[model samples]
Target chain A: MSQAACIVGIGETDFCRKPGSGMSQLALQLRAATAAIQDAGLTPRVIDGIMPFPNLGRAEQFAANLGCENLRFAATIHTGGAAPVASLQAAATAVNAGMATHVLLPAGWNGYSGARVRQTVSQDVASIPGGAIARDYYLPFGFTAPPQWYSVMARRHMYEFGTTPEQLGTIAVTMRKHAQLNPKAVMHGRSMTLDDYLASPMLADPYRFFDCCLETDGAAAVVVTSAERARDLAAKPIQIMSGACGQPYPADEITNRKDFFRTGLSIAAPEAFGKAGIGPSDVDFAMIYDCFTFELLQQLEEAGFCKRGEGGHFVEGGRIELGGELPVNTHGGLLSEAHVLGMSHITEAVRQLRGEAEGRQVEGAEIGVVTGWGDFGDGSIAILRR
Target chain B: MSEYTKPLPELEGHTKDFYGFCKQGELHFQRCSACGTWRHVPRELCAECGSWDWEWARSSGRGEVYTWTVVGRALHPAFQQSCPYAPTVIELEEGVRLLSEVLDVAPEALEIGMPVEVVFEAVTDEITLPKFKRVAAS
Candidate 1:
């Protein structure tokens, strides 16, 4: 357990689902990184470390281009949606150990509609060393796509708790409603009805087009340093009070696990909460990862926001709205916002802390919890406050 | 049912129709004889105890439908013809759960904890996916 590292600055390329923006992934990542540095009011020359999400920048060359001389902190992480919080945790550890003064965590992707729709696997995507032994068993069954893999949960929830399609659509619609207020949200003002949801096409059954997220091309980055030193910087301090990364105990995929009702995410949320000395109810806002609609609900239940099987009712009561008990995905979300490579939720948390969010702003928001998207049994959590 | 067929995804691993029973309208679970635990992906070794002693056995394929989602729209080129289908997860009677399609049942008829049984669906010439149908209430 290391000391808390502060997130002093955050920046992002505009969120859009369009192609032919004429920006390579490297350039887009640089735009976000440089903006993060400037947002922290620090010179790029001061940054000595960088942790980019997979496919964003070309490793060492990216650092060289950023003019980071003698870069001491550098690495890349995969597991798709979980990269944001995990990379931030890496940066925080580096800051705590005095490995680097300023750290940059950037992510980018440029395949929405231009060259191809989107690739489900990276050239380097692989099975984990120890526990990922189920590729032989499940891959042959068409349980490949990460979202479709999550469909196991969706089905189980319906069987165990009577969860319905409309209940899942409620999550999507809520995220879209919030996106309508966020200028950077791709689906902003682009409303989707439940009928449109039910009538849409299916990917793996039980998951329709609207039930899944879009593939967008963009980038985002955040700056981290000592919370004490962050006060001296020109940017407002967004404290990274608690952070953690964990995975399912030696399992292949979610379906192969013992408990289908509770996921490993539940294992992560409490650890971050204990580190932050705050409970789920104490937080004023949440920036949960939503690669698929049912997962968000499943995560909510696992994170202790509500009891098991209670999420359907909790969300249906408008508890997830901007003016509700605790507004979730205020900057929209992966569901309605731009689905960058990863870390979109972290960037949204930064915006919420800075109070720069236009229409999706929660009134007087002072606390927030952000999560990472990891499948392959990996997950991470972060607790932040203004 | 329409005569038109939808192309299914090609999965690599087993050379023979190892999972063919699921397509033959039956649920099969793999048992690690050395460790005494059930596995989803048919394997040669015990995933938990690392024992190579294993065999594929028939399961009741009768369990509660744990969770499911009703996809609102078509997502893939292969799925365009099958919009608005209920992809379900059925927890088999053997304490193992598998992702499966709930067929011949209307969307409104789906209920959590409802009893279901396995049915064979020939997705491709060499592939048969195990689908589920709700047990009719007496």
Candidate 2:
């Protein structure tokens, strides 16, 4: 909140199921990082800060690859899917503090081509055995994967709010429709109907195959700098109007949390909107993370877009479609688009603000909100304005 | 059900008593001796009172099915043969929650707020797993 920080560039690697070309994570990250720098009409030499998602370590490797001469600040966030935009908070802080000039924010994962398949049956995964507090409590009861773990929350939502599977299916259907317009989307050209969603095999109770996001292999990067620098750059500056990351009490474990129906976003949205000098109604569009369909619905309600328990009705009737009020995930989202750990959601918001979202543009869009959800209950939100 | 081995919980300093009670076929929770706050998944100190002084208080094992999921897909080698199983979270009468496998009812029949009670199953020589079965409506 000191000096305004702005996102001046956005870039991403091609969406692929498998990078059989032996595409390492570093290669994917550098490609997006280079593209983002070039997109901002700035050279890598100007980048002095880097905020990366976990596993993409050491800013020096990135600086070396980008030809950046002075990498002054570097940090990595491991807050699950929420880290990408959540990381922007740290970058903006550094930029506001004058600790760094331009910062590169990147996220990518080879879930399809990498350890995802190998990890399906392997017990060697460190995080699997008594790694997290929640795991220690839930694993013994046969709650192994996310689908099973999150199903508890999903079922509760249904019981408390009468949220139906069809309502959840609406989200998947809406995202797939949006992906149809985005050529870069992994599910582009592949259509899904509500029937398909209902018919999809159940991974866990209340979660069918369509309820989950794709295990994608891709990366996205954004360039953040001072508002002054952003204005001189090539892309229209997306002002960091407001941003926050929060975890409510007992956030470490789902069972220990006070209210499963409420998430950290319930606390964060007010802070973010207040900082932006706006409200959820004032926002033109949203890029809510869709790690699962239930999460999408819950976040919408928790973010104050609708009354709690009303997200099911709010998303109905094509309200979240491209031409609907507060169009969401115009670039398909993780469900249909490539899951770049929600960084691509940031990129999509940038595109919408710049009027560059060709087929999926929300007309007269000047303000957009992007969000991230992870770590059982950690939530992050940011409001951007053109 | 076919016999198999799965990853078990580590019975450390804080968790030993909780599982030790399980070996005796009794459900117990960590209650802060100072503040009388009930806690689950055993911790070193009480969250409410920040007091390390606590005692393993026996639970009545009577609770309602708060939420549940039927994992149609197997995630671990131990569960490969049990392709579809129900994992449930039960909120005990004492206002504390714990995770366990739900049995004696079809997955589709599981409902929120349904009464349930705990039953122990000795899965391995060293570890006894706690499970839940739906209580008949009185």
Candidate 3:
């Protein structure tokens, strides 16, 4: 049998709100990819597989730019923000099946410097997920942004579960607090109290400005190989225990879902935890996707860390803070960290497993979980162990 | 009419019929002939079954507020003038949800399970949107 897949190298470009000259999307991706290849103690020519983020670029283009020749396996995960974590499954499967020796996964975009979702007027329906639905049903009603689309679910959650704005504020405050320890975080040293969170301008009802993630122009990359080959690599290997991706019913549209509270994580978390022979309690730390404050809280409940509707209380009393029960988003998160489409969450997971997280490191952390929340409730989860 | 600066639905393919129905001052959804499952934002096949047999059935134009959000900032350029509007999801009596604006209702007065009924507005000669209003207690 082939050895289990392991992550040997991880690299990321500087997370920033704005990019200087020459920081195109592809440029950011190439910078991160080169760093990861070198960190793995290998050259570009040795990499035999590639997985690129959907709609950003193609695998062949990335392979050619990185000087990676003789590529065997190539695939792109189209699960939106969930693409990065979902790509791990494809990379691991390729390596263990002898289809490839080394697989490189890269995800990034010029969210700030280029086409921003909030600012850009999308004319091509083919480019966006559920474009027809959005154009026909949503945009006509002035619901044109992510915060507007997701706020309905958050509002329903508040109505059914009695979730509060303060509960959601706790997540924003905690993530900003965690960002304070990492200098790479875009919001590092920008202190925010719970009062500050409440004082932030409301973008969408039930979602204050602080509830949203940063629109960053950056990239992050990871190198995966079999466990046997990882023994010879320069960096310590963090085993890819298991990972999976899932979509909620009628994945593209959220308004018609039979159960409003159920999300893609509600389906994926069980399968991922089952495959790993572990549960939420076994996780030493987690990198739950923090695209929004309510989203992070919802993922926590859906991922089985807490029961449904209990997320509002689960985050209170500093339980998710650095020293608390389960330190979440130790390298900040999409909320305070740059939003490289959740790829930074995976890099942070690797850093935690390698005991290189510096001041924000969870001491003696041997196992961790990373999750991704994408367009319209799509979710992916990966469990890693040192 | 102030040029109706907001976005208008792209009436094409499966979506053309939906907008056509609205333009006629009526609301309808595709209901599967095989399983009787009503669906919206029109598609070809039934979600519950694999049947392609469906029809655009007229609705009673009544529903309850399932969920809502009050937009304090308009993300789109055309909607900048309409700041602080409420976009709502109305669960129609036919068991389908439609996203539309709730007219003449204060944002604070919107509540889950509040009864509402559909109303029409002709934004342009080509499109008539189906908006909603709170049903007075009777």
DockQ-derived CAPRI band for the predicted complex in model 1: acceptable
Reference-based TM-score of each model: 0.82, 0.96, 0.97
Between candidates 2 and 3, the DockQ winner: 3
Q: Write the per-residue lDDT of candidate 2 for residues B58-138, one digit (tens) a residue.
A: 999989888888888776667776868888888998999888867787888888888988999887777787888888865
For A187-236, candidate 3 gives per-residue lDDT tens digits of: 99998999999999989998999999998888999999999999999999
Predicted model with the maximum DockQ:
3
Cα-based lDDT at residue A340, candidate 2: 89
lDDT of each structure?
Answer: 0.72, 0.84, 0.88
lDDT for A222 (candidate 1): 88
Clashing pairs in 3: none
Which residues of candidate 2, in runs, are more than 4 Å off?
Answer: A18-21, A117-132, B1-3
Instruction: Pull out the clashing pairs in model 2.
Output: none
C-alpha DockQ of every model: 0.27, 0.63, 0.81
Off by over 4 Å in 3: A18-22, A121-124
Chain A TM-scores of each predicted structure, in the order given, are 0.93, 0.95, 0.97
> How well does candidate 2 score on lDDT at residue B48?
88
True contacts kept of 1: 0.37
